[model samples]
Target: MNESSDLQRFQELIEASAERELTEVETAFIGRMGFRSEQCRQWLEADAEVVAAAVEQDPLRTVPAATTLDWARVDAGLRRAGALPDSRAQSRNAWPLLPAAAALLLCIGVINAILRDGLSTTPQAPPEVVAEVLDLPEGDGSLILHEGDDEGVLMIILSNG
Candidate 1:
Protein backbone atom coordinates (compact mmCIF):
# COMPACT_ATOMS: atom_id res chain seq x y z
CA MET A 1 0.00 0.00 0.00
CA ASN A 2 1.05 3.65 -0.64
CA GLU A 3 1.55 6.28 2.06
CA SER A 4 -2.10 7.53 1.99
CA SER A 5 -3.51 3.98 2.26
CA ASP A 6 -1.06 3.19 5.04
CA LEU A 7 -2.22 6.34 6.90
CA GLN A 8 -5.91 5.46 6.35
CA ARG A 9 -5.43 1.91 7.64
CA PHE A 10 -3.53 3.25 10.65
CA GLN A 11 -6.35 5.71 11.38
CA GLU A 12 -8.98 2.98 11.08
CA LEU A 13 -7.02 0.68 13.44
CA ILE A 14 -6.68 3.52 16.01
CA GLU A 15 -10.42 4.28 15.88
CA ALA A 16 -11.24 0.55 16.17
CA SER A 17 -8.94 0.23 19.21
CA ALA A 18 -11.14 2.68 21.11
CA GLU A 19 -14.14 0.29 20.82
CA ARG A 20 -12.43 -3.14 20.93
CA GLU A 21 -9.08 -4.83 21.55
CA LEU A 22 -6.66 -4.52 18.58
CA THR A 23 -5.35 -7.79 17.13
CA GLU A 24 -1.63 -8.65 17.45
CA VAL A 25 -1.01 -7.69 13.78
CA GLU A 26 -2.88 -4.36 14.20
CA THR A 27 -0.97 -3.65 17.45
CA ALA A 28 2.38 -4.41 15.70
CA PHE A 29 1.42 -2.06 12.85
CA ILE A 30 0.57 0.71 15.32
CA GLY A 31 3.86 0.21 17.18
CA ARG A 32 5.88 0.27 13.95
CA MET A 33 4.10 3.45 12.77
CA GLY A 34 4.64 5.08 16.17
CA PHE A 35 8.37 4.48 15.87
CA ARG A 36 8.48 6.23 12.45
CA SER A 37 6.10 9.15 13.10
CA GLU A 38 6.51 11.77 15.88
CA GLN A 39 2.72 12.47 16.16
CA CYS A 40 1.89 8.76 16.35
CA ARG A 41 4.63 8.28 18.99
CA GLN A 42 3.12 11.08 21.15
CA TRP A 43 -0.41 9.63 20.83
CA LEU A 44 0.85 6.17 21.79
CA GLU A 45 2.70 7.56 24.84
CA ALA A 46 -0.39 9.49 25.98
CA ASP A 47 -2.57 6.35 25.67
CA ALA A 48 0.00 4.30 27.63
CA GLU A 49 0.01 6.86 30.45
CA VAL A 50 -3.81 6.86 30.57
CA VAL A 51 -3.96 3.05 30.80
CA ALA A 52 -1.20 2.94 33.46
CA ALA A 53 -3.01 5.52 35.61
CA ALA A 54 -6.31 3.65 35.30
CA VAL A 55 -4.80 0.31 36.36
CA GLU A 56 -2.74 1.71 39.24
CA GLN A 57 -4.13 1.15 42.78
CA ASP A 58 -5.32 4.28 44.60
CA PRO A 59 -3.80 4.76 48.13
CA LEU A 60 -6.92 6.56 49.47
CA ARG A 61 -9.33 3.83 48.32
CA THR A 62 -8.63 1.49 51.30
CA VAL A 63 -10.48 2.74 54.40
CA PRO A 64 -8.90 2.58 57.87
CA ALA A 65 -10.76 0.72 60.67
CA ALA A 66 -12.91 2.85 62.99
CA THR A 67 -11.45 3.74 66.39
CA THR A 68 -13.28 2.52 69.52
CA LEU A 69 -14.86 5.19 71.79
CA ASP A 70 -15.24 5.36 75.61
CA TRP A 71 -18.78 6.71 76.06
CA ALA A 72 -18.32 7.31 79.84
CA ARG A 73 -15.32 9.55 79.21
CA VAL A 74 -17.21 11.43 76.47
CA ASP A 75 -20.13 12.07 78.81
CA ALA A 76 -17.81 13.27 81.59
CA GLY A 77 -16.10 15.71 79.23
CA LEU A 78 -19.41 17.08 78.00
CA ARG A 79 -20.63 17.61 81.57
CA ARG A 80 -17.38 19.40 82.54
CA ALA A 81 -17.72 21.71 79.54
CA GLY A 82 -21.33 22.55 80.55
CA ALA A 83 -22.59 21.17 77.21
CA LEU A 84 -24.73 18.62 79.14
CA PRO A 85 -26.79 19.09 82.27
CA ASP A 86 -25.82 17.39 85.57
CA SER A 87 -27.25 13.87 85.96
CA ARG A 88 -28.57 14.56 89.48
CA ALA A 89 -30.16 17.90 88.46
CA GLN A 90 -31.73 16.27 85.37
CA SER A 91 -33.33 13.59 87.53
CA ARG A 92 -34.54 16.09 90.15
CA ASN A 93 -36.30 18.30 87.55
CA ALA A 94 -39.97 17.15 87.63
CA TRP A 95 -40.79 18.76 84.25
CA PRO A 96 -41.71 15.36 82.81
CA LEU A 97 -44.68 15.09 85.30
CA LEU A 98 -46.30 18.28 83.89
CA PRO A 99 -47.92 16.40 81.00
CA ALA A 100 -49.41 13.79 83.38
CA ALA A 101 -50.68 16.52 85.71
CA ALA A 102 -52.33 18.38 82.80
CA ALA A 103 -53.97 15.17 81.63
CA LEU A 104 -55.34 14.49 85.14
CA LEU A 105 -56.74 18.04 85.38
CA LEU A 106 -58.44 17.63 81.94
CA CYS A 107 -60.07 14.38 83.11
CA ILE A 108 -61.33 16.01 86.33
CA GLY A 109 -62.81 18.97 84.37
CA VAL A 110 -64.61 16.62 81.96
CA ILE A 111 -66.07 14.60 84.84
CA ASN A 112 -67.19 17.79 86.64
CA ALA A 113 -68.96 19.06 83.48
CA ILE A 114 -70.69 15.73 83.01
CA LEU A 115 -71.92 15.63 86.60
CA ARG A 116 -73.12 19.28 86.45
CA ASP A 117 -75.07 19.05 83.17
CA GLY A 118 -75.54 15.46 82.03
CA LEU A 119 -76.92 13.14 84.79
CA SER A 120 -78.19 15.44 87.60
CA THR A 121 -81.40 16.53 85.76
CA THR A 122 -84.62 14.50 85.58
CA PRO A 123 -85.12 12.37 82.39
CA GLN A 124 -87.78 13.47 79.81
CA ALA A 125 -90.37 11.21 78.16
CA PRO A 126 -89.67 10.08 74.60
CA PRO A 127 -91.89 11.26 71.68
CA GLU A 128 -94.41 8.72 70.37
CA VAL A 129 -93.81 7.01 66.98
CA VAL A 130 -96.58 5.80 64.58
CA ALA A 131 -95.95 2.35 63.10
CA GLU A 132 -96.98 1.57 59.48
CA VAL A 133 -97.24 -1.75 57.68
CA LEU A 134 -95.90 -1.84 54.09
CA ASP A 135 -97.60 -4.03 51.44
CA LEU A 136 -94.80 -5.66 49.43
CA PRO A 137 -94.94 -7.78 46.23
CA GLU A 138 -95.18 -11.54 46.70
CA GLY A 139 -91.66 -13.01 46.31
CA ASP A 140 -88.78 -14.30 48.42
CA GLY A 141 -88.78 -11.89 51.40
CA SER A 142 -86.19 -11.03 54.09
CA LEU A 143 -86.48 -8.83 57.24
CA ILE A 144 -83.35 -7.24 58.72
CA LEU A 145 -83.41 -5.51 62.15
CA HIS A 146 -80.48 -3.45 63.51
CA GLU A 147 -79.79 -0.88 66.24
CA GLY A 148 -80.01 2.80 65.21
CA ASP A 149 -77.45 5.61 65.75
CA ASP A 150 -78.42 5.92 69.48
CA GLU A 151 -77.35 2.32 70.24
CA GLY A 152 -80.00 0.87 72.62
CA VAL A 153 -82.24 4.00 72.37
CA LEU A 154 -83.63 3.28 68.86
CA MET A 155 -83.97 0.41 66.34
CA ILE A 156 -84.32 0.17 62.53
CA ILE A 157 -86.00 -2.52 60.42
CA LEU A 158 -85.57 -3.21 56.69
CA SER A 159 -87.60 -5.66 54.55
CA ASN A 160 -86.69 -6.84 51.04
CA GLY A 161 -89.33 -8.69 48.93
Candidate 2:
Protein backbone atom coordinates (compact mmCIF):
# COMPACT_ATOMS: atom_id res chain seq x y z
CA MET A 1 0.00 0.00 0.00
CA ASN A 2 1.04 3.59 -0.52
CA GLU A 3 2.04 5.84 2.43
CA SER A 4 -1.36 7.58 2.48
CA SER A 5 -3.17 4.24 2.58
CA ASP A 6 -0.87 3.09 5.38
CA LEU A 7 -1.56 6.31 7.36
CA GLN A 8 -5.34 5.90 6.86
CA ARG A 9 -5.07 2.31 8.06
CA PHE A 10 -3.01 3.48 11.08
CA GLN A 11 -5.74 6.05 12.01
CA GLU A 12 -8.45 3.41 11.64
CA LEU A 13 -6.50 1.03 13.88
CA ILE A 14 -6.06 3.79 16.52
CA GLU A 15 -9.83 4.43 16.39
CA ALA A 16 -10.54 0.69 16.71
CA SER A 17 -8.11 0.46 19.70
CA ALA A 18 -9.84 3.47 21.33
CA GLU A 19 -13.13 1.60 20.98
CA ARG A 20 -11.43 -1.44 22.74
CA GLU A 21 -12.29 -3.76 19.82
CA LEU A 22 -8.81 -4.16 18.19
CA THR A 23 -8.13 -7.85 17.51
CA GLU A 24 -4.87 -9.56 18.58
CA VAL A 25 -3.76 -9.59 14.93
CA GLU A 26 -4.26 -5.80 14.68
CA THR A 27 -2.37 -5.30 17.98
CA ALA A 28 0.52 -7.50 16.77
CA PHE A 29 0.59 -5.67 13.47
CA ILE A 30 0.72 -2.22 15.17
CA GLY A 31 3.41 -3.46 17.60
CA ARG A 32 5.52 -4.68 14.75
CA MET A 33 5.14 -1.37 12.88
CA GLY A 34 6.02 0.67 16.06
CA PHE A 35 9.10 -1.51 16.66
CA ARG A 36 10.35 -0.77 13.17
CA SER A 37 10.05 3.04 13.43
CA GLU A 38 13.18 5.14 14.06
CA GLN A 39 11.07 7.73 16.01
CA CYS A 40 9.90 4.99 18.38
CA ARG A 41 13.50 3.94 19.03
CA GLN A 42 14.53 7.56 19.69
CA TRP A 43 11.59 7.99 22.14
CA LEU A 44 12.61 4.82 23.98
CA GLU A 45 16.22 6.10 24.19
CA ALA A 46 15.23 9.67 25.43
CA ASP A 47 16.80 10.94 28.68
CA ALA A 48 14.85 10.01 31.83
CA GLU A 49 14.89 13.62 33.15
CA VAL A 50 13.57 15.06 29.85
CA VAL A 51 10.77 12.49 29.73
CA ALA A 52 9.92 13.19 33.41
CA ALA A 53 9.88 17.01 32.87
CA ALA A 54 7.63 16.66 29.83
CA VAL A 55 5.24 14.14 31.42
CA GLU A 56 4.98 15.70 34.89
CA GLN A 57 3.97 19.15 33.54
CA ASP A 58 0.16 19.40 33.47
CA PRO A 59 -0.93 22.41 31.33
CA LEU A 60 -4.32 22.62 33.04
CA ARG A 61 -2.73 23.19 36.48
CA THR A 62 0.57 24.83 35.49
CA VAL A 63 -0.94 27.38 33.08
CA PRO A 64 -3.09 29.00 35.75
CA ALA A 65 -0.26 28.87 38.32
CA ALA A 66 2.18 30.54 35.92
CA THR A 67 -0.22 33.19 34.57
CA THR A 68 -2.12 34.42 37.66
CA LEU A 69 -2.73 38.22 37.73
CA ASP A 70 -1.20 40.23 40.61
CA TRP A 71 -4.12 42.13 42.20
CA ALA A 72 -1.93 44.73 44.01
CA ARG A 73 -0.21 45.72 40.78
CA VAL A 74 -3.57 46.00 39.09
CA ASP A 75 -4.91 48.26 41.87
CA ALA A 76 -1.85 50.53 41.72
CA GLY A 77 -2.23 50.83 37.96
CA LEU A 78 -5.89 51.73 38.40
CA ARG A 79 -4.96 54.46 40.88
CA ARG A 80 -2.29 55.87 38.59
CA ALA A 81 -4.75 55.92 35.70
CA GLY A 82 -7.18 58.06 37.79
CA ALA A 83 -9.81 55.35 38.08
CA LEU A 84 -9.65 55.60 41.90
CA PRO A 85 -7.86 57.63 44.59
CA ASP A 86 -5.52 55.91 47.01
CA SER A 87 -5.73 56.49 50.77
CA ARG A 88 -2.76 58.89 50.68
CA ALA A 89 -4.41 61.17 48.10
CA GLN A 90 -7.71 61.08 49.98
CA SER A 91 -5.96 62.24 53.17
CA ARG A 92 -4.16 65.01 51.27
CA ASN A 93 -7.43 66.20 49.73
CA ALA A 94 -8.91 66.66 53.22
CA TRP A 95 -6.48 69.57 53.95
CA PRO A 96 -8.90 72.29 52.74
CA LEU A 97 -10.09 72.85 56.36
CA LEU A 98 -6.76 74.46 57.32
CA PRO A 99 -7.81 77.94 56.13
CA ALA A 100 -10.96 77.91 58.30
CA ALA A 101 -8.89 76.89 61.35
CA ALA A 102 -6.43 79.70 60.68
CA ALA A 103 -9.32 82.19 60.33
CA LEU A 104 -10.70 81.15 63.70
CA LEU A 105 -7.29 81.64 65.33
CA LEU A 106 -6.97 85.05 63.70
CA CYS A 107 -10.40 86.13 65.04
CA ILE A 108 -9.43 84.97 68.54
CA GLY A 109 -6.15 86.89 68.35
CA VAL A 110 -7.92 90.06 67.12
CA ILE A 111 -10.46 89.91 69.98
CA ASN A 112 -7.63 89.43 72.49
CA ALA A 113 -5.70 92.38 71.07
CA ILE A 114 -8.80 94.63 71.17
CA LEU A 115 -9.58 93.75 74.82
CA ARG A 116 -5.94 94.33 75.88
CA ASP A 117 -5.75 97.73 74.19
CA GLY A 118 -9.14 98.74 75.61
CA LEU A 119 -8.11 97.81 79.18
CA SER A 120 -4.67 99.46 79.03
CA THR A 121 -5.93 102.85 77.71
CA THR A 122 -8.25 103.54 80.67
CA PRO A 123 -7.15 104.86 84.18
CA GLN A 124 -8.31 103.00 87.33
CA ALA A 125 -9.18 105.33 90.20
CA PRO A 126 -8.58 104.55 93.90
CA PRO A 127 -11.56 103.66 96.13
CA GLU A 128 -13.03 106.37 98.44
CA VAL A 129 -11.30 106.54 101.89
CA VAL A 130 -13.46 106.49 105.04
CA ALA A 131 -12.14 106.91 108.70
CA GLU A 132 -13.48 105.71 112.02
CA VAL A 133 -12.22 106.88 115.50
CA LEU A 134 -12.38 104.56 118.51
CA ASP A 135 -11.25 104.84 122.20
CA LEU A 136 -9.43 102.09 124.13
CA PRO A 137 -10.89 100.75 127.39
CA GLU A 138 -7.59 101.32 129.36
CA GLY A 139 -6.74 104.93 130.29
CA ASP A 140 -3.03 106.22 129.72
CA GLY A 141 -2.44 104.88 126.14
CA SER A 142 -2.00 107.11 123.10
CA LEU A 143 -3.85 106.90 119.71
CA ILE A 144 -1.67 106.65 116.57
CA LEU A 145 -2.65 107.44 112.96
CA HIS A 146 -0.87 105.80 109.96
CA GLU A 147 -1.30 106.52 106.24
CA GLY A 148 -2.10 103.71 103.80
CA ASP A 149 -1.65 103.48 100.03
CA ASP A 150 0.00 105.98 97.66
CA GLU A 151 -3.05 108.28 98.12
CA GLY A 152 -2.08 108.83 101.82
CA VAL A 153 -5.41 107.75 103.31
CA LEU A 154 -5.32 107.69 107.12
CA MET A 155 -5.93 104.49 109.14
CA ILE A 156 -6.69 105.24 112.90
CA ILE A 157 -5.50 102.97 115.70
CA LEU A 158 -6.33 103.57 119.46
CA SER A 159 -4.26 102.41 122.51
CA ASN A 160 -4.65 102.81 126.28
CA GLY A 161 -3.89 106.49 127.26
Candidate 3:
Protein backbone atom coordinates (compact mmCIF):
# COMPACT_ATOMS: atom_id res chain seq x y z
CA MET A 1 0.00 0.00 0.00
CA ASN A 2 0.97 3.69 -0.34
CA GLU A 3 2.68 5.32 2.68
CA SER A 4 -0.41 7.35 3.76
CA SER A 5 -2.73 4.31 3.53
CA ASP A 6 -0.22 2.29 5.48
CA LEU A 7 -0.18 4.96 8.23
CA GLN A 8 -4.00 5.08 8.36
CA ARG A 9 -4.20 1.29 8.57
CA PHE A 10 -1.51 1.31 11.27
CA GLN A 11 -3.52 3.82 13.33
CA GLU A 12 -6.71 1.74 12.94
CA LEU A 13 -4.84 -1.33 14.02
CA ILE A 14 -3.49 0.38 17.14
CA GLU A 15 -6.96 1.64 18.10
CA ALA A 16 -8.43 -1.83 17.61
CA SER A 17 -5.57 -3.34 19.63
CA ALA A 18 -6.37 -0.97 22.51
CA GLU A 19 -10.02 -2.03 22.43
CA ARG A 20 -9.31 -5.80 22.04
CA GLU A 21 -6.77 -8.15 20.42
CA LEU A 22 -5.11 -7.38 17.07
CA THR A 23 -6.39 -9.11 13.93
CA GLU A 24 -4.12 -11.58 12.09
CA VAL A 25 -3.10 -8.95 9.52
CA GLU A 26 -2.33 -6.43 12.31
CA THR A 27 -0.25 -9.01 14.15
CA ALA A 28 1.74 -9.71 11.06
CA PHE A 29 2.23 -5.99 10.33
CA ILE A 30 3.41 -5.26 13.89
CA GLY A 31 5.89 -8.12 13.69
CA ARG A 32 7.16 -6.87 10.32
CA MET A 33 7.46 -3.31 11.77
CA GLY A 34 9.83 -4.73 14.51
CA PHE A 35 7.55 -3.99 17.48
CA ARG A 36 8.03 -5.96 20.68
CA SER A 37 4.51 -7.41 20.76
CA GLU A 38 4.04 -7.72 24.57
CA GLN A 39 5.40 -4.24 25.42
CA CYS A 40 3.46 -2.63 22.56
CA ARG A 41 0.24 -4.26 23.74
CA GLN A 42 0.86 -3.11 27.32
CA TRP A 43 1.48 0.52 26.16
CA LEU A 44 -1.76 0.48 24.15
CA GLU A 45 -3.73 -0.80 27.14
CA ALA A 46 -2.23 1.89 29.47
CA ASP A 47 -3.03 4.63 26.92
CA ALA A 48 -6.62 3.44 26.73
CA GLU A 49 -6.92 3.51 30.53
CA VAL A 50 -5.54 7.08 30.64
CA VAL A 51 -8.02 8.26 27.98
CA ALA A 52 -10.94 6.61 29.78
CA ALA A 53 -9.91 8.12 33.13
CA ALA A 54 -9.56 11.59 31.59
CA VAL A 55 -13.06 11.37 30.10
CA GLU A 56 -14.55 10.10 33.36
CA GLN A 57 -12.91 12.82 35.48
CA ASP A 58 -13.67 15.88 33.30
CA PRO A 59 -12.98 19.24 35.13
CA LEU A 60 -16.36 20.81 34.22
CA ARG A 61 -18.21 17.81 35.62
CA THR A 62 -16.27 17.94 38.95
CA VAL A 63 -16.60 21.69 39.68
CA PRO A 64 -18.67 22.57 42.82
CA ALA A 65 -21.74 24.80 42.56
CA ALA A 66 -20.99 28.48 43.29
CA THR A 67 -22.11 29.85 46.70
CA THR A 68 -24.67 32.72 46.49
CA LEU A 69 -24.14 36.16 48.10
CA ASP A 70 -26.56 38.67 49.84
CA TRP A 71 -24.60 41.95 49.57
CA ALA A 72 -27.49 44.23 50.69
CA ARG A 73 -28.03 42.36 53.98
CA VAL A 74 -24.28 42.28 54.67
CA ASP A 75 -24.00 46.03 54.18
CA ALA A 76 -27.00 46.65 56.43
CA GLY A 77 -25.47 44.57 59.24
CA LEU A 78 -22.12 46.38 58.98
CA ARG A 79 -23.86 49.80 59.09
CA ARG A 80 -25.93 48.84 62.16
CA ALA A 81 -22.75 47.66 63.95
CA GLY A 82 -21.01 51.00 63.16
CA ALA A 83 -18.09 49.09 61.57
CA LEU A 84 -18.08 51.24 58.41
CA PRO A 85 -16.92 54.87 58.47
CA ASP A 86 -19.09 57.76 57.16
CA SER A 87 -17.60 58.54 53.70
CA ARG A 88 -18.49 62.27 53.74
CA ALA A 89 -16.98 62.92 57.20
CA GLN A 90 -13.82 61.00 56.31
CA SER A 91 -13.30 63.00 53.12
CA ARG A 92 -13.96 66.33 54.94
CA ASN A 93 -11.42 65.51 57.69
CA ALA A 94 -8.76 64.48 55.13
CA TRP A 95 -8.94 67.64 52.97
CA PRO A 96 -7.10 70.07 55.37
CA LEU A 97 -3.88 67.95 55.28
CA LEU A 98 -3.64 67.85 51.45
CA PRO A 99 -2.36 71.44 50.97
CA ALA A 100 0.27 71.04 53.73
CA ALA A 101 1.59 67.79 52.17
CA ALA A 102 1.62 69.39 48.68
CA ALA A 103 3.52 72.44 49.97
CA LEU A 104 6.21 70.24 51.60
CA LEU A 105 6.63 68.26 48.35
CA LEU A 106 6.86 71.45 46.33
CA CYS A 107 9.56 72.83 48.67
CA ILE A 108 11.58 69.62 48.33
CA GLY A 109 11.33 69.71 44.53
CA VAL A 110 12.40 73.38 44.38
CA ILE A 111 15.41 72.70 46.66
CA ASN A 112 16.48 69.73 44.49
CA ALA A 113 16.23 71.81 41.32
CA ILE A 114 18.23 74.66 42.86
CA LEU A 115 20.99 72.29 44.07
CA ARG A 116 21.28 70.64 40.61
CA ASP A 117 21.43 74.01 38.87
CA GLY A 118 24.06 75.35 41.30
CA LEU A 119 26.30 72.29 40.81
CA SER A 120 26.10 72.58 36.98
CA THR A 121 26.76 76.37 37.05
CA THR A 122 29.93 76.20 39.27
CA PRO A 123 33.08 77.72 37.61
CA GLN A 124 35.96 75.41 36.61
CA ALA A 125 39.68 76.50 36.38
CA PRO A 126 41.37 76.67 32.97
CA PRO A 127 44.31 74.28 32.25
CA GLU A 128 47.89 75.76 32.20
CA VAL A 129 50.57 74.79 29.65
CA VAL A 130 54.29 74.24 30.65
CA ALA A 131 56.80 73.80 27.80
CA GLU A 132 60.17 71.98 28.30
CA VAL A 133 62.93 73.14 25.94
CA LEU A 134 66.21 71.25 25.38
CA ASP A 135 69.57 73.18 24.89
CA LEU A 136 71.20 72.68 21.48
CA PRO A 137 74.95 72.06 21.03
CA GLU A 138 77.17 75.17 20.62
CA GLY A 139 77.76 75.53 16.92
CA ASP A 140 77.28 77.94 13.94
CA GLY A 141 76.59 74.84 11.85
CA SER A 142 73.45 73.58 10.00
CA LEU A 143 72.05 70.04 10.28
CA ILE A 144 72.12 67.79 7.16
CA LEU A 145 69.92 64.76 6.38
CA HIS A 146 70.95 62.48 3.47
CA GLU A 147 67.78 61.00 1.94
CA GLY A 148 68.12 58.08 -0.53
CA ASP A 149 68.91 59.96 -3.74
CA ASP A 150 71.76 60.50 -6.21
CA GLU A 151 71.73 64.09 -4.95
CA GLY A 152 73.88 65.23 -2.03
CA VAL A 153 72.76 66.06 1.58
CA LEU A 154 69.75 68.34 2.45
CA MET A 155 70.70 71.20 4.88
CA ILE A 156 68.52 72.56 7.73
CA ILE A 157 69.61 75.97 9.08
CA LEU A 158 69.25 76.87 12.75
CA SER A 159 68.11 80.31 13.91
CA ASN A 160 68.33 81.78 17.50
CA GLY A 161 64.99 83.61 16.91
TM-score, model 2 to reference: 0.25
Q: What is the lDDT of residue 34 in candidate 3?
A: 32
- In model 1, how large is the Cα lDDT of residue 11? 79
Indicate the worst ten consecutive residues by lDDT in candidate 1: 140-149
Q: In model 2, where is the ten-residue run with the lowest total lDDT?
A: 131-140
Compare the candidates by lDDT and give the number of the best one.
Answer: 1
- Candidate 3 wrong stretches, greater than 4 Å: 34-161
Residue 137's C-alpha lDDT in candidate 3? 41
State model 1's lDDT: 0.56
lDDT of 2 by residue, 1-161 (tens): 66455555655676678778888888775676556655443443557678667777766544554223576678779998998788667754553355335434544554455445432334544333333223433222333343344535554444323
Error of 1 at 82 (Å): 50
lDDT of 3: 0.50
- The global Cα lDDT (0 to 1) of model 2 is 0.53
Ranking of candidates on lDDT, top first: 1, 2, 3
lDDT of 1 by residue, 40-110 (tens): 66655767877777766665466564444666678779998999888856744653355335544544554
> Candidate 1 vs candidate 3: which has greater TM-score?
1
